[model samples]
Target chain A: MPPEVEGGETTERVLQILSTSARLFATTGYDGTSMRDIALACGISKSLLYHHFADKDEIFARITLGSTRELVQFVESRLPEGAAPSLRIRAFMAATGEYFQRYRWAWIASTTAFWNDPQQRRQTERMLWRDRYEGLIRRLIEEAIAAGEIRPLDVPLAGRLVLSALNWMHRWHKPDQGMPAPEVAEAYFDMIFHGLKR
Target chain B: MPPEVEGGETTERVLQILSTSARLFATTGYDGTSMRDIALACGISKSLLYHHFADKDEIFARITLGSTRELVQFVESRLPEGAAPSLRIRAFMAATGEYFQRYRWAWIASTTAFWNDPQQRRQTERMLWRDRYEGLIRRLIEEAIAAGEIRPLDVPLAGRLVLSALNWMHRWHKPDQGMPAPEVAEAYFDMIFHGLKR
Candidate 1:
């Protein structure tokens, strides 16, 4: 095999392990899941798994880091350059809900990892992505206010409210049930932009 | 001591243990905390602690149950016999924010427990309170719609959004920090009632 192809295969194998591990961890939880379980779930030997990850925590950390990075990138990628602030906010929420729906295990694993493990490295990485994600939303809201699209309010608190509503989607959103992400996002945007009052 | 006073003292002691355990659990997580740690924190013997509750799980269950009941009662108490739908919704959010602030530990413990442990009984109990709480909010929203106070939207999704914003308060709301519960509630209610539009 060519050198680049060999490297690509290795990367694919590693991603496969991480994906399987995330599913297992999401269902059984981090503490309940074992390395053997992950290896078994991935249909790989324990030795092969060890070759890729030092241990379960390493696998978990990698999964969380990758998932967070992917979510931020996905949302950022969805935004058009020089978009209006309202358009930016709408795109962000719609993309986020869709991302969570498509990558349910990643969302669950990343969320669980942040709360379950307080290791310094994991904490720093989690906070980095969290701050970036929240920062983007805050900036959009600020722009909206500056442009006179939305009324001025407590910026930090408003950011928290917006992010909280979006993040909570993972908990109740089921792809097979209820409104799809696009419709849900529309409802959210409508309520958010128009308030509940008639 | 009189029988009633003796019973009250025992109840108080149990509550004290639970309160201390909740604080420890919130700070150190459930797995990080032990019976010995809770006993030591409560300045009581392990036997005395066991006498009131069978185990840590039992203590946790009682704490969660009590906290849920108290929150429901508090919110209920805050509403008058026949208030406006908007008033009812306002009372619910304000009371919930205040309840979370006052019993921060309970909120932390209960949330952590629901996510960390998948015990059937605990799941059922958590859902019971959650459903009741969400149901109340949904009913209030429905009433608001009928009263023509708020425009019709996805009721369930709106409930989730509202609850998410309020629940997320526990993560960021510090009594000694930036915005107090009432002020935060005001901001939330305002944003919730009126859209971001100028």
Candidate 2:
């Protein structure tokens, strides 16, 4: 049984299991931890865990979906259309970059596993994210091109290039090292916007 | 127990094992694989596996070292210093990015768990690579700035930013998509070096 804080809804319980699972999964990789371990860690019985989630696969899919939605919402809300192309691009990437700081493990796990045994759910998640991110970047490239703020390049490929830079933040960034996510994002934004010029 | 293929002292068996293991480690993740499986897949005895590599960790170390050396060599070798600053910067990033295409998995693996692990050997490899890559980048940036190619910005940070773009290639690129790595790098090189200009 999950904590009463989740109320009596099974979906809430599933979500609870998922949140706890993501935290645990992030620390211990998916293969290293077992369902029994997850159930024990989450304070739920095996049957109840099964009742809420069919298996680890189901839970991972659910968590990934939630993560994708949260990312989309985060970026969409942060974007101010009326801003200059440069500013808009900064805001856009910064929001996503900062969000990655909290949830870097998801990226760590998902990105490393993109080509390996991509389950149907994982494939769907990949498509959704790639399309959404590419679409957002397409707009940025278009705006920048129109304003002559940046150089003309393939929007989809350019988006991939920018996303690649932001994606690695989780790999090397350490919060205790005194760098905040927003600051790192700004550094990257500065690199993207102005480059290494005085 | 290991097939001694005729070739260089490294041996075809050695190369086969390395390439296969690299893919397995990248796909299944290091934590998910076992020596038994690797041995079986390579058609070698576990003892033979040990002959070629001490153990799983050693294999991991070699892969990291091998890929890093390849990267360091490629960057240093391909970046012609006498070229114009604009051309040099673009060529430098393009060559580096092109490396990401074939060894995308190796690059991603080296930069993450291999770098993050507290193990001394991995750490040493990480530092070696960090210094080798960053040192080259610093030299290039200094030259470019002195030559009045780009505005003087933080060289170290700019190096990291540029690298992040190239490293993320493992996540999004698909060989089946028909876009060659060189072409991809060229496209991104234009975006990074020239910016969005008419």
Candidate 3:
């Protein structure tokens, strides 16, 4: 069961727990982290941590599900309605990068964690959210193709090409490095949209 | 020191040990796997496993270094000496796919392992090989730009764009699944070479 969110205080405390857990999981990796470690990191007693989360797996599941939900909502909020397909696609990429930068640790934890455990409800739900995100991108590409803004190519392949560049950033894109995530995403957008032909 | 290879039989036995260890590390993850587990999986005694290598770290390091060396050689051997920069890039990608298929587990383990382990010699050496591989691609891009075969752009960024798509494949591309890696790579190459815009 999901943790109880009794009120603002309880919700905030839960968020704090999740935030600390995400950082631990992101840096040390899921296997290396434990509930005891999370509690210690959060300066809470083990009983208190367990009061909020049943176990490490539940905490991880909560973080992954919450991160993906926020990602979808953030991207949807930024997508411009009635804009050209290409602009909409660029907007999608930019919004994704912005979200990633804002929640770098949580995003990393969610993306890199092993989510294929046997028929777990939380894992299944997270996959559904991921599918929604992918579907949204595919629809944008399909719209672009139909409008003749882009070449008529394989829709799934096109979607993967675009998503691959954006998705792989967490491995290399430093949080406070040379360029911000959104700008780096724009560079990728330019490359994908404009062929390298001189 | 590296494992001793006294003769052809010893070399083959070491290869067998490395191959089994690679598959375990690839599937169970480096941390999730144990030296004893590797020995059990290999149907060998713990003493025999210890005789081959010091520990799991050494086995992982050997697999990573060997896989990278083979990758460099395979890509270089496939590269056409006088071909256009574009064709050469395509060849480089195709060769990577072939190598990946041939040594799927080893490639997966090497690429996904946490290599930044505080200045260990094997990890450091593996990073050097990885750098060499990246440098090869960057030089190829530089040649393409100089030859006027492609638009002059941020060479590193362009290289990242291409590598990201190819590198991200291990996550979603299953062995014996929908499309072969080379064909998938070709589609990516086409989309990257000719921009999505008509």
Candidate 4:
């Protein structure tokens, strides 16, 4: 086989390992899981697992960074170019809810019990990504306010509230239960855009 | 000493242990702590500590249960008697925010790393308390809708969104920086009740 094919095969195996580990970590939690457990779950020898990754922390960092990047990209991709600020806000909220719904394990893994002993690099990566994400939302809110699409308010607080609600969806959203992500997003949008007052 | 006085001293000691352990667990996480650490922090012998509580797990259970009870009581006490639905909603939101602010350690300890290996009883207790809390919120929403104080929507979903925004405050709220708890509560109330649409 050519060198490129060999490299591609190695990349696929690494992806498989990361995906499997993410599921296990999400379900059992980081501390509750071990490298041996991951190896067994992946049906690979310990040495082989080590060859693909340095350790469990490396695998965890990869998954978290990967998930965060994907979430950002997913939201950005869904956002319409040159759309009204209100429409942009709706798209952001809907995409966020849907991303959490689809990548439930990734969200769980990034924010749950494993956060206690995060590597410095992982923590920095998360903070940077979070800042960027929040900055985007804050800008959108500012735009909406300037456009007179929404009332003036605390931009940072407003952004935080919206992000918090969307982030919390992973904790309770079950694909099999209740309304689908789109409907849930619609209800949330209605509530956020229109005051609860009749 | 009189029997009553002796019992009172014992109760004080138990409370001391619980308070100190809650701080430690909150700051360092449960798995990061040990019985020895708790004993040192409490300035007591490990044997004495064990005498009061069977183990760390027991201590954790006691703190969590106590905190949950206090949170329920706090919200209940703040709720005005025979008030309008909107007022009741305000009280609930304010109380929820304040409870998390005051009992920051308890909220941190209960929700963080130790949640993975929870005893069956602890899980059941958490579920029971959560059900009660959510039920209360849902009822308030239903009452608000009936009173035409707010538009009709999915009661459970609305309740979750509100609770999520409140609960996520612990992750980001800084008492010394930015808005205080009451101010934060007011902003949330405004956004939640009045929405963003002008």
TM-score of each: 0.92, 0.81, 0.92, 0.92
**How would you encode candidate 2's per-residue C-alpha lDDT over A86-192 as one tens digit per residue?**
78888888888777776665555555445443367676865687678668877887898888887666777777767777777776777657567777787777766
Number of the candidate with higher lDDT, 2 or 3 = 3
Docking class of 2: acceptable
DockQ for each numbered candidate: 0.63, 0.44, 0.64, 0.68
Minimal lDDT window, size 10, model 1 chain A: A1-10
| Candidate 1 - chain A - TM | 0.90
Task: Give the fraction of true interface contacts kept by model 2.
Answer: 0.48
Q: Quantify all predictions' global Cα lDDT against the true fold.
A: 0.78, 0.69, 0.82, 0.79
Candidate 3 per-residue lDDT, tens place, A129-172, comes to 88899999999999998999998998888888888999899878
Candidate 2: tens digits of C-alpha lDDT, residues B71-111:
77776778765787666666777777677766766665665
lDDT for A65 (candidate 1):
72
For residue A112, give model 3's deviation from the true position in Å. Answer: 1.8
Off by over 4 Å in 1: A1-10, B1-10
Best by lDDT: 3
Model 2 has a DockQ score of: 0.44
Clashing pairs in 4: A195-B194
Question: When superposed on Cα atoms, how far off is each prediction in RMSD?
Answer: 4.0, 4.7, 3.3, 4.2
Where does candidate 3 chain B have its weakest 10-residue lDDT segment? Answer: B1-10
Candidate 1: global Cα-lDDT? 0.78
In what order do the candidates fall by lDDT, top score first?
3, 4, 1, 2
Candidate 2: segments with Cα more than 4 A from true spot: A1-17, A39-52, A104-109, A112-118, A147-151, A195-198, B1-9, B43-50, B81-88, B102-105, B108-120, B176-179
